[model samples]
Target: MALKLLSALDAAKIQLYHFKAIIIAGMGLFTDAYDLFCIPPIMKLIGRIYYLDHHNSDKCSVMPKETQYKTTPTAVVSTLVSIALLGTAVGQLVFGRLGDRAGRRRVYGLSLGMMVLSSLACGFSICKTRNCVLVSLGFFRFLLGVGIRGDYPLSATIMSEFANKKTRGAFIAAVFSMQGLGILASSIVTMVVCRIFAVSSNEPKSETPDEADLAWRVILMMGAVPAALTYYWRMMMPETARYTALVEQNVVQAAIDMKKVLDVPMSEIAEDSPIRLKPPVLPHPSYPLLSKRFLRRHGVDLFCCAATWFLVDVVFYSSNLLQSQIYHRFIKDNNDVNGYKLAFKVARFQAILAISSTIPGYWVTVYFIDRIGRVKIQMLGFLFMALVYFAIGIPYKYY
Candidate 1:
């Protein structure tokens, strides 16, 4: 038993392409992050461009009129941001099943195609007519979700299958860490756009807020550029060898592909290695995925990981969507005032706060995850979150 365990670990070590695969899969995730987080910073901008401030008048407007220029309604803002999540939900359901059926590489490529298309569709949201623009933005956001959906399961599965066994935990975790990279990129992009808008915003002729709104469209369009490049990158890569072996029942081809990936000659390939010419006789009496053995153990791990992911997204995204407001409060409390400067300050401070919140949690999990196991860490994290929520909820009820 110890020998078998050691062999698995050894096999994992020999596997290098899996790490490459994780990076490739991570690019797709970066796209997901860009599409998902880009909305909030632009939410206020979109509202000003559309229903909120339909006219670009210079009159000193009153209460609701001031709000039209100053604030996007909570409901509208939530709907806009949540629309992307909705796209994610649909994309996940469709792409998850399709990826399993169509092969990971093809499905991955398809997801990218959708991403490029949907991102371009967002540009269409810059319509001259307000109603048309609002409708287009919502539709395109949902279209973006369609692409965002396929990423998680497909990336996780590919990253896991490709990774060397011993490093699987580290590789998967690292792939997710790139999510932060995408977020950081989005924030930077928004900052650049904001700077441009601020510059244009000061122009004698730029009295209209709609002129300022051009910044967001530029940012949205910038996101599509990376996805386009990724699509080109993905086009050059081959299908995962493990996926081919397990799903396609092509052991001979799997071995050949494995050799190419490992850069090993057939003669030098270890005879005792599990990459066999003959397919292993997986146990029968039918559906392995639905079997009691697979369900009780593997299923539970998958369920836990997914649920934890969902919960984290809800809290993190909600906080991010409210980031500007949070920063405004901090500014107000501190009695610091400057719209253009504050926008940039709030954005940077918010990014810093976000990094601070996530990094320790991420590092702690990354450090202990392999040693202690994913399931335990996930469960404990969920429990801690639940307890925090409960304590907060209890206090709120009493107050």
Candidate 2:
């Protein structure tokens, strides 16, 4: 039964269903990337609206009504930014194991459901007091982060399970490449919203106009649309044949799933079965996850993958979440730019990076990964990242 389903899956040609798998799975990643990082671009607006510098309220009317929005307190801002990362770690640990135990499809939509509800909650989180509103947002974002990161493992698993062996690398690469689209989408939405509601900066007062209050809410809520769509589509996806056959030990159910997904014929699959499955090569069948032997066998490989991914995420999300602050600090602007302009500038910069760096790198990996190999490509990537980081960091003060 294993051989029948496994061999058919391996031998199947690329079909429309394969692309469906990519789109369905890829959009989860898209929503995750967009929602997770969207906060930074609009955080200034958030501060202006919610954390309005009331201590300086007396100054607002006396000092030419010039917009004098104080920067959000550092501790609060850090919590807002880092809380999502914390939620992501928690979600991955929880959902990953759940996927293994219950079933991938069973648990996949739970993350997106959390994302849609939390994203909407963030958009509407208003309170009479400043602290109440900020805390509410933080809590909702924590839940959103849990939903966003849950897609990380599930998408790759689905893509790998469906893709033919010959080009499985490209398919999985395509799944991650969706992150670029997500980032770009978020930036474009923020930019358009800011532009449409462009408020003239008050020369006398430092407070943002009422229009910005609306714009930021729109930005936070917009993440729900795509996430909701992805949820519906993911629900339609059938469970992977590999799980149904190999893990569940249900050959008939696995065959039905394969019939729906792959291009193989019914006759070839339904014939009286006498074939045997080759046991996948492993050091020991009894070596369970977290066992000492399991660790001994895969320890170095595990460490490298985890450490590299960890470092990369640290760099990626920090730069994304702190981009506005970075631009304000070092880019050396002479004119007193308003919050809307600052946000637009940051959005533009992120768009450029997505187009030139993130998007291209992702697609290039998809195209060349199988031909050139994963390890070599990863090394080349680290080399470039190292060079760019040094170039930016070494001259931090001079710029």
Candidate 3:
């Protein structure tokens, strides 16, 4: 079996296959971000639908002079919004290990399937009682979160495996940048649905509750479309050469896969035919992460990277939690809306933020990450984040 797999990967030129890999992984990220962020714009509609104050005269009203509407309890709102995150944590841990043991390609499709099915389930969770709907929505969303989180490690691992050393970071960053597009798409989808269902701003807010009801479900299920579309390509993708050769120790199969991936002749990839070898070469020894040998070899790197990532994600998701609050505070002092107006406003705001910040931020990382090198770019990112935090009087410690 072939021994020159790593060298071949290192030496290969960028090809259509590489870009296709990027798109496949990027679509997963797109689905992940869409599912994660879609809840915020539609929260008010959820409240209007489920948290109505029946005794109030203007209960869930859609009049021209509509003044206020009931909001769900803060704790209930918090639970509904954050349950997906809890599911994601569990999914990441479970799927991360499973991807290693069972196989990346196999686990990849399962995670995506989980996303598609759970999204539809969340949408289909219409119920006669509020409690019934909340319970079903929360549970299905948790499952959706589990599926959404798997996109990260799987996409990153697959992209890294497919990329050459020189362009690896850029490829992975490109995958991540797709999240920006997903977020923007979520906002745009909300806007379009609301426009279709909602009356004009100058008109009475008397559009039937059924319209808003149908709107949120449509938004939630839209995630399933892209995710389901991506799954076919994801399953069509070959298992990575690195995993097959290095983990499974099937060097001959890895060679053939690489030949297809690299779209090069076997002779050009390696000196001899892989089948001519009597038996596969054993994979290099790997260390258990908890072992002393492994720690000594990788401890500092692991700690630094993990800590850095933890801090970033903490800030990132914290912002997500705070985003709705921030918008409501600035836009309307958290005033409740009896119609779809608030959702439409929030959607517009989200689209604006995507255009001004999120899209540019991710695309900049994609374009500059390789040229600048990872560590330096990371340092710059931290510097910018720190400056923003400091300006806002939030204390942060760098790892």
Candidate 4:
């Protein structure tokens, strides 16, 4: 039998509200993916605009020694890329707790606001020197990362709480699927911006400082659009019934809120009834996460989740953040192209790869995750990844 407090949520029929919740949650992820993937192309553009002469001038022996090759250090570029990740880690820990304490709806809008403001800040990063510019950009991006990371826990929790159990998995999957769209959007926007600047410039083969500077800013600032668009809807959303009924122990309010959401009428109960009188309380015994009982009960599961996530992120971020480097190594004949043109080429390549591979992979997961089960899919994915890595590595090493 379903728990009285949860029966309404579990038994409720899937409706338009479910789709709205998915879109609201998914748009946050879309913004997150767009902001994150957009950086690599911009990073490459930065190198070309600010450091190409220093890094590349030595390669061509005939080049003049006096050539101004102002280069931002590799460490600085890496720092700019990695600092946001660090902020994300912190935000997840901090906001996950905050969401529980303050309620989801109240804290949800804060993250979106931070994302919008910080994205604009990142686009407008300005300073007298290359190092200063990098520092400014890094700081804003770190803040942006914090906001983006908060969405993960908040969105998942909200969607799950709002969904009927029969279709819960699908709703959550749909929300996460928006991330692929965000990635596609980033690539498309970057390609379009770069192409426009490249074609319009009279000296398409030579770097134009003005065009290069404007292109990156435009890309970075565009991340704010999706987040800004969704903010009002997020704010207007009611607190999830799960949070109110279970967390707050306010059964009456929970029923009222859910009635409106599900478009179903709720029966009125006596004020003196047990459901109306129960105070907010935690379902589990009050114990710290590190308590012996918790460790004994769930330690292994927790450890596995943490370890797997760590490994996955390490591989995922490294591959994505360094994709431009891989592209440079494979395509070395772009000397005649200007920095903006090169950036366009990189963006187009990434977009093609995303459309052909990454985006499809997300949908495949969405379709099969419920039918095949998470464990089997995860195991198969890991096995495939391992085999592919070995095949590539062994050949390259021996040859």
The digit string of per-residue lDDT tens for model 1 on 173-194 reads 8777767767777777777778
Q: Candidate 4 — what's its lDDT?
A: 0.78
Q: Report the number of the highest-lDDT candidate.
A: 3
How many residue pairs clash (N, CA or C atoms closer than 3 angstroms) in each of the candidate models, in the order given? 5, 9, 1, 3
Runs of candidate 1 with Cα error greater than 4 angstroms are: 1-18, 51-69, 204-209, 264-285, 288-305, 326-328, 331-346, 383-399
What TM-score would every model get versus the actual structure? 0.80, 0.90, 0.89, 0.89
Candidate 4 lDDT by residue in tens digits, 1-399: 115648767877878988999999889889998988898778767866666555565664766333434334678768888999988998898888899988898777888898999999999897636778788999999999999888778988899899887777767878888887887899899988888877787763554455687889899999999999878888877899888876777877777777776765454221235565455455675777889989899999999988987887887777667666644554342445566766676677777777886777677777887788777877877787688668756775453
The 0-to-1 C-alpha lDDT of every candidate, in the order given, reads 0.67, 0.79, 0.80, 0.78
Where is the poorest 10-residue window by lDDT in model 2? 330-339
lDDT of 3 by residue, 237-278 (tens): 889988987777677778788987686667655646534333
**What is the lDDT, from 0 to 100, of the residue 227 in candidate 1?**
79
Tens digits of per-residue lDDT for model 2 on 99-153?
Answer: 8767888889888888899999988876535778788888988988888778789
Off by over 4 Å in 3: 53-68, 199-203, 206-208, 271-286, 333-337, 393-399
Task: Judge candidate 3 at residue 165 and give its lDDT.
Answer: 84
Q: Of the pair 1 and 4, which is ahead by TM-score?
A: 4
Candidate no. 4 TM-score: 0.89
